[model samples]
Target: MGRMDDRSVIVTGAGRGIGRAIAERLAAEGAAVAVTDVDEDTATGTAAEIGGKAVGIHADVTDPGSVRAMVQRAREEFGRIDGLVNNAGWDKIGPFVDSDPADWDRIIRINLYGVLHTSQAVVPVMIAQGGGTVVNIASDAARVGSSGEAVYSAAKGGVISFTKTLAREVARHGINANCVCPGPTDTPLFSSLFEGNDRLRDALVKAIPFRRLARPDDLAATVAFFASPDATYLTGQTVSVSGGLSMV
Candidate 1:
């Protein structure tokens, strides 16, 4: 049997890039995934491509009401939510002194508050079902400060702390929580960060011990592992999938 046979999962921001990779990986392992994104077309397309019990749903992570409706739809479609991957996030790269307050607000809303809304929505479902797993997609910046990602790093740091606290609170219910920190992954988001700067990209690649940036699949594999039965005894942990970039 597949690792996630009969499991139902929600992967937010799953339209493309890292989120898409995670959803596709989980589906390949036999889980029915709810591929959700703010963009309905891409979300639906991804769901169609997965072509099983998967469903595409619209969810604006920054908005709790939208998140609630999305979670409700998943529960209605799948009967139960066995897993939740908080993969929705956004960032603006620049020095803190040069950053605008609006940028900070956006970063906090999508990266941090987004987790809060989704986790709060999913935990109840998991509780009623007796147990579940939460694999949060944080960033290596949170562990070791990134030069251009001050607010983003702070938001992700919050995620790590929140995951640990949530893990402690939910362990009694058999639920587990963990964080996966990806460093310089070759996703659209990564590309956007270095839009016209191939030098920056090349320098980053050379710095990684693997001599390359991480692939979305790398993070996907870690996330899947945490969601699997193999990681039943693991919780409140933070793992970095950065090709040995930051060993903290």
Candidate 2:
């Protein structure tokens, strides 16, 4: 049996990239996974690809109603939610001084408020069920700050703080909340940010002690650990999977 045998997990933005990797890992570890995404096709497609006790639900993380519906759907399919991975996020690259407030609003909505919406809808279920684990995907940018990602960093920093506070409040209910911060990951989002800028990508790779960008699986493994029985005693903590790029 896998580490997550018989557990049920909901992973947001699970159509591609890191989210997809997390879903795949959880499913492989014997967890029934709810793979949610804004795009219905991609969500269902990913669920089909994972091929197990996995279901896909379309959910807009930025919307409370949508998040609630997604949670309801997961509960209907899996009977109970034993884990939640808030992995949905978006970002745009530009100097903070040059960034538009609208963009900042969008970033905050997806990266920070999304976490709030999901946790609010799902935590009560966990409490009712006696226990659950929350693995929030924050960012190394939030911990160390990154150029051209000021607003994203601020939003993710709020996630880290919110997660810690949630952990404290929900520990009495047997809920564990923690944050995972990934750095310079090799995903479509990362590629989009550095399109035609190979020099910057190369420089970043050289800067990391690992001499490479973090694979989605790297982040996935850590998230799985958080969701598994291995992390029952861990809560209100933030882990950085940055290949030694940020050591704080």
Candidate 3:
């Protein structure tokens, strides 16, 4: 049997990139997943490819109403919620000094507020079910600040702190909360951040001890571990999956 057999999970931002990889990995381990995304078509497409035991639902994590509906759909489809992966995030790579106030709001909304909305929507379900797992996809920038990602780093840092506090509050209820920090992974978002800047891309590659960017699968494995029975006793912890990029 797979590690997550018969479990039902909701993975936000599963339309593509690291989110998609997490969903696919969990499904392979026998978990029925609700692939939620702000983009309806992309979410549905991801669910379709996964075949039976998966469904795509529109969820805008920045909107509480949308998040609530998304959770409701997952419960209705799967009968119970066993795992929640908060993987939706966005960032604008540029010096903070040159950033607009609007940019900060966008980063905070998608990166920090998104996590809050999803967890608020899903945590109660897990508590009522007697137990569940929550995995928040943070960034290595949270642990060690990144040059061009000041606001993004701050938002993710908030997620890390929030996870710890929530974990303590929910431990008695058998719900686990944790954060996974991914380093410079080779994803669309990452590419877009450094697009048309070969020098920056090459510099990032050189910084990593492995000399190669992290594959989506590299991150999926860590998230899977957090959502599995193997991590039942592990909570309030932050694990980094950056291919030796940031070691603390």
Window of ten residues with lowest summed lDDT in model 3: 46-55
- Flag regions of model 3 displaced more than 4 Å: none
Residue 80, candidate 3: Cα error in Å is 0.7
* Candidates in order: C-alpha RMSD to true structure: 0.6, 0.5, 0.6
Residues 1-248, candidate 1, lDDT per residue (tens digit)? 78999999999999999999999999999999999999999999999998888899999999999999999999999999999999999998898999999999999999999999999999999999999999999999999999989999999999999999999999999999999999999988889889999998899899999999999999999999999888989999999999999998
lDDT of predicted model 2: 0.97
| Candidate 2 lDDT trough over 10 residues, lowest sum | 69-78
Write model 2 residue lDDT over 37-134, tens digit each, in one string: 99989999999999999999999999999999999999999999999999999999999999999999999999999999999999999999999999
lDDT (Cα, 0-100) at 89 in candidate 1: 92
Per-model tally of clashing residue pairs: 0, 0, 0
Score each candidate by Cα lDDT: 0.96, 0.97, 0.96
TM-score for each of the candidates? 0.99, 0.99, 0.99
